[model samples]
Target: MYLNSTSPTPESCEAVYPDLASAIRCVREQWCELHGYTEPFCRNGVWWVFPPNGVIPVCIRDVMNSDKGQWVRIGRVSVAILPDGSFAIAPKSTSDRTD
Candidate 1:
């Protein structure tokens, strides 16, 4: 899942895959297939492609169109696309702080 943001970071943000880690892993293996590194990652059981765009599974536009300032959680990790065009993800077990 993704979310819209207005915080001064990338124009959008990233997230998700329902047990798609292997798929992501496949993408990661082929980073060169895209313009640059895919920046694939897994937090808790949730997989994500950060700075997403035409290269990855999702893009900034996806976040830009989502509910702003909302957090999208997958398992123990969560993705929160801010209201200032910035986005972040953190473990649900940790502090809510995004420093």
Candidate 2:
């Protein structure tokens, strides 16, 4: 599967995956790298958070039914599961922007 990201430079955002397992692994690795963490505390196998301390529970809207990818904020991080099955991760700034 060719999982792509939404950005001006699509070529740089694109990734190839031979299988779903490998794709999931890549997502986890990329997310960890983005946060500069050797390991991150993942919640419910979907949401990931760092530090692993005093994390208040937050409700996140289900994005499974959306045809297009939807960015959902979970505390300090934002997560989006794309239609092509790629996961997008970004830190939520104070301005509440995903970019």
Candidate 3:
């Protein structure tokens, strides 16, 4: 479910994952399809995509700083869209931490 002027949601939208790992797997698969590259995974509780041309980080920082709720958990994993039109995955619990 894209909130506004953004990219399309990943495939398997209705199929729910039982855990964060499964959710990340689904996100990664979808991201790979969209970007034509291997998807990056969460590192140290944060997922980030560094574009080759120096794009801003596409982490949840954008949405988290927006009008949306300070913390959002999609299914079981925390998510963010990078500036390069990539996706970031984080632990659902980290949404509470100060940005």
> Which candidate number would show the highest lDDT if scored against the true structure?
3
Per-residue lDDT tens digits for candidate 1, residues 1-99, read 222234422323244434334333432334323434355455554444555355545342343333344443345454454322244343354476566
In order, the Cα lDDT scores of the candidates are 0.39, 0.41, 0.43
lDDT of 2: 0.41
Task: Report, for all candidates in order, the number of backbone clashes.
Answer: 9, 0, 2
Query: Where does model 2 exceed 4 Å of error?
Result: 1-15, 41-43, 52-99
lDDT per residue as tens, model 3, 1-99: 323344334432445556655554554445444544343545566665543344554543332332321122457544454322344454457768887
- For model 1 the TM-score comes to 0.21
For candidate 2, the 10 contiguous residues with the lowest summed lDDT are 57-66
List residue ranges in candidate 3 displaced over 4 A. 1-12, 50-99
Residue 79 accuracy (lDDT) in model 3? 46
Measured against the true structure, the TM-scores of the candidates, in listed sequence, are 0.21, 0.34, 0.33
List, residue by residue over 1-99, the lDDT tens digit for candidate 2: 122254322224345455555555555455445434344344655543342243543222232233333343333344444422355454456899656
